[model samples]
Target chain A: MTGPLQQVLGKAAEFGGTALAKLQHTHVPGVGQASTTEPREVAAARWRAVTVFRDDLAGPFPELEALGPDLEVRMQPAPGDRGTELSARFHGTPTDEQVGELRAALRRTKQLAEVGEVLRVDPQPHGTRKATLQGAALEGAAARAPKEGVL
Target chain B: MKAAIWAGVNEVAVEEVDEPQLLNDHDVILKISKTVTCGSDLHLIGGYIPAMRAGDVLGHEFTGTVVERGKAVTKVQVGDRVVVPSFIACGHCWYCSQELYSLCDNGNPNPGITEGLWGQSPGGCFGYSHAMGGFAGSHAEYMRVPYADVGCFVVPDAVSDTRALFASDSVTTGWTGAHLGGTKPGDVVAVWGAGAVGQMAARAAILLGAEQVVVIDRLPERLAQVRQHIGAEAVDYSTTDVVAELRERTGGRGPDVCIEAVGMEAHSTGIQGAFDQVKQQLRLQTDRPSAVREAIRACRKGGSVFVLGVFAGPVDKFPLGAAMNKGLTVRGAQQHGQRYVPEILAHMESGALTTEHLATHTMPLSQAAEGYRIFKEKEDGCVRTVFEPGG
Candidate 1:
């Protein structure tokens, strides 16, 4: 464990025993009462990260080896998709924020590799693809918007 | 940049809008030279499509000089003349890999809308409607093309600007209809609507060695073009019972292939049209399938029914029973343009296809609204109205 996330969780554990002891039987607004103590498999899941890529986010699994020496980054085919899913078992459990940040980092790497940056639609060119709905366009209208252009 | 914005139903305006910047690696910006008004555009302008936003830039069929290209673009270079099809296809999707470019998975950025309606989304289109992936339109001084390598095709020097322009949408769409319909040697093909698409479909079938091609339309000029330019038979559906005439002409076997290039806003003669108009007015059926209706009934048993028309909503009385029981093969589609642009361009260069006569009027971009008005009203026998952005 390293950085502020490590320190925050460490300090909480030192003061309240285990991290789960700090927030036992927590109440979530919409989800109702949440069990602070989860099953062993669910607890083990916190340290793992799964990211789905629509376009090819995966190139080489270079980052997976950095988690630990014995950590085997299991590469598997994502269900019902052609994308590759990579998972790594960390040596130490990571905080929820750390897992989210890790997922975002993976996504950012994908954006850099595939699109050169996160793809943006703004500064939308005068003529590009449109993504809106109206009229009979919804029911059965084929792509016959109009000939506002000149040949 | 000044652009023709879809301000309201049947309304257009030349408004000063932001110059589109190259936003992606494979993007290209075109200094638009020419654009043409198409028959389908009338659906949006007349408010039949009803998806146009107040400030949406309208216009899609265009040919322009490439002014800039994104980092990943390699096929097209700056200063080259290029024509892009209206439909947007990302070359890497499973759908595109299968050569069904129109049904590209990544084409429509907002897939939920189309998914709810069609159960699956089609590829995006430029300057089409928001329902089409509302890319700003090509009616401006500059237009941006995403997946530039996939959609942009270079226009040969031999193909004149006017000739190359229709290749973007109208010609390609017509070509798609004919090509996908499997037009074969000695086939007797019947096409509905003698407009741009119909003309091209007839010509394509002729080129594909069809023995006879019959084009049906109400307009005299469009039918005249079918006879004179296309060298195909014309059926004045307004004067004759289209199904009966087609059957009689085809020696009771009907045409071997019936192509429906006329789209959602179809009209019929007499009582059927009256019934459709009433049903349409009451919001019961969004599509008037007279052209499609007649086409199915007119096609021979075991013949192929190719539908190149655009039907947005459901129709009440589709002749599915005839199609099913008669062993008629019904295939309708938006243009899978990426699959056909190469051959179509080759045809254009080889002089087998000449589309220059289709552009009946040309106006400066500043007067784009007037061009659309002429198109909407069909004044001056305007089959197509071209606009010059630099003018």
Candidate 2:
């Protein structure tokens, strides 16, 4: 029974991640992503970027560089002394999972360059999770959070 | 370890939970001394925020002794008594450099949830919700604090835990409103809602050299507290017209600054109140925002209005036209506690700021559910209930 439950939760976590990705692209009436719905190729073709606070950001950013040889990475000084703008995109259209990896890599690059260590929250503490479906879904959403966002 | 958990919507319970551990190089573990229920926590408790999961820990404002430290934590040592801001921020972020710690880009790990609701996400808050950060709250006996050197401030030796605890959220949040609302010397400031945050806002205005500060609230107990503890004039909005009264007191020019400390669930007496309640219940609007409406209407032309409240989403009848036509500089943000904690501690040390009055009830962690109950219902004049997790 425990094995089955774990398997179900694992699947739920995957679903949660996919749902979040869809949520970003989906248009809601009053609120949603700033961009309108676009072709998948158009969405994936755009460069994803985050600005690091260090003005002297010269990157051998291990996180983004690790993606592959096909990934195009760029760095430039941001305006008004904000710091460096680091951006990346694949040579061709990438899968949702690939986009998710890029997002996570960009965030980690910023964290590592600025704070020197990525912040962590898990293995902290919690009361008993009641094994409810919504609880599992939320757990899944949180697991995918490092990779999902406007960035 | 015993901690308060959000059992369900409008439900809280005390449960034995796993103790926290240092999860990162910059993290520190705290033996929580005192953790208090905040008005903002009510939104999470009532399912208004919609990100809270059952069994999630419930607290943000707390004072504690650092019991353990990670390698990267240097500013605070083990056994140092400290108060952490509700928001989690890495000191290295651009927003943190700008002293806008609440808008730190790296704080909220679960940005997708918030970015989906709000166009952009702010910093993470403890025990608020997963959308802010799934970080466990301070209600437990021991809790982990990330970015210790950035977020934790040592409580001054002269300040007791009870007095210093409010600095974690209320005083800092209030200071954010008064300071950013641009209250200058000789300015007349009007603060709506005399809850802990509202009272603190009014007090901050006074300390910032506001010529006159008035706090408006419907609750007699909170209003009286504003007068007695905060040393600010109190108005019973239930009994009087708030805008007219503020205008009258400000010599018909209206207040130079208006701060709305009442969040989504603002109370009003007449048709507007009924309409807001109905709309909220019917899911037509996510927030009530009656105090905001009043603040904008009452603010002097070209004056400033700052919202310190924790509103989740859009409200009906917002009076944006009044805000625009009046040329009001309207701004709102979560409390940037990191920017103001040092000054607040200094004020606390000097006995210039008194916050012990806000902790009207103190009890063991076992009573947190009941504590939240009395606080939410405003029963027995309970302003805030401080829970001693160690006890």
Candidate 3:
């Protein structure tokens, strides 16, 4: 690939990764899953949570505690005995990177509690990675998937 | 090890790839015995699902012998002949606890891709796409299976590999549609697409005590298989109007349950068909929902419609008004195989559910490109091409 082509493909891959994360926060009429029209501040202010399937969720939650003292973590019994609702939010305005970190931390905490190990997908069997723009974009999206989502 | 992979759009090839290892304590490695093509795989191959990249491994419905085991995997053992479900699920999740394994929270490691598209991610599926999970598929000689105790079921001693193989996906998926669509005694059931999933769906309805079942398709070979092997009535939509024919067969009340096994690439006739084809090709709509539209229209008032096909995104010309007016219950999902595989295997053992006929063509993994060509083109009466990776 030429230098210009390589640069364009690299940008496309980056766009693929960030665009997915952007969609979670953007409410597109009839096109996106995000139903929220809240401002960025309000969306970030709200508690992000996962319903853990365990009734007895005690902590020493190392995942949340590692997020620093500025984060407030809480847990409550979920309705109908579904499990505990583990939630967290920043004390002050947080950057998008901080929010992404929180999301990844919460997911890892849930996985470690439920499945005993964080699930891995990389280093698995796969063929050549063609240098096409679409393939590169998808590769970027998969790379950023764990740290990006409604979580 | 040799495996089939998606090289590019409408391109498939056999390549030597690295073998999978135990990624999680609950995972196991399987030396795959039999893996077959599914209608859903065509969506990935054709690039209709945007998440698939080139060189992604491609088979999912499979049976294999457990070659290695993780330390925490207590129930399943090495050397166990098992048929693994395509959707990987953490057995103890709330959704898995509720028998909705496909909706598992812990399955998809890469949740953002699907969460962005569908609001929430379901479970991860082997070899489907990154939107589901980036797990390697079973088309290879050996593959890793996560959550083995929940997803892998030991094949019965009496059941052969071919028979037990369909139980992994086709039969279980069919049973999911029939059982969840609320098929009951004396009800008339109509299935769209006389492919393997459609045939199996009709058979499942019959086993569930439906008094009448009819399968609709354009292929004469598949229709013949429906009547001969599945023991159900067949409707050739090429010659007859499916809605009118179904109504006439059911005494004008229409079918009590309508199941669509045709996925995003459904075939139709006249202007509607041309319209869908053009829209899909132009990237206006992500899927062709001709079968779903027909099902909703043909279903009786207060009837239930279950979608057994795999649809990626939105479709144009959906029959929402008809569904609302008729009080139809429309539901669709990726198959929750863990919930239904046991009963399907039992049925297979008794010869009550015959799925070996669905594997119309069998070949070595090296002929994967040709196999997919025949299966996709529907030439040579190839309902499915079962790949023997080790051969």
TM-score of chain B of each: 0.98, 0.99, 0.99
Provide the DockQ value for model 1.
0.08
Report the lDDT tens digits of candidate 2 across residue range B1-391: 9999998889899999988888889999999999999999998998888777899999999999999999988898999999999999998888999999999998987887787667678999999989898889989899899999999999989899999999999999999999999999999999999989999999999999999999999889898898889889999988999889988998899999999999998889899999999999998998989999999999999999999999987788989899999999999989999999999999999998999999999999999999999999999999999999977
Q: What TM-score quantifies how close candidate 1 is to the native fold?
A: 0.77
Error of model 1, residue A130, in angstroms: 18
The digit string of per-residue lDDT tens for model 1 on B9-74 reads 777888888899998888899999998888788788877765565677888899999999998999
CA lDDT, every prediction? 0.74, 0.90, 0.90
lDDT of 3 by residue, B261-333 (tens): 9999999999999999999999988899999999999999999999989997788988899999999999988
List, for all models, the DockQ compared with the true complex: 0.08, 0.70, 0.79
Q: What is the lDDT of residue A29 in candidate 1?
A: 28
Worst 10 residues of 3 chain B by lDDT: B112-121
Alpha-carbon runs more than 4 Å astray in model 3: A1-6, A25-29
- Better candidate by TM-score, 1 or 3: 3
**Candidate 3: clashing residue pairs, number:** 0
Least well predicted 10-residue stretch by lDDT in candidate 1 chain B: B110-119
B133: Cα error in model 3, Å: 0.7
Best by TM-score: 3
| Candidate order, TM-score descending | 3, 2, 1
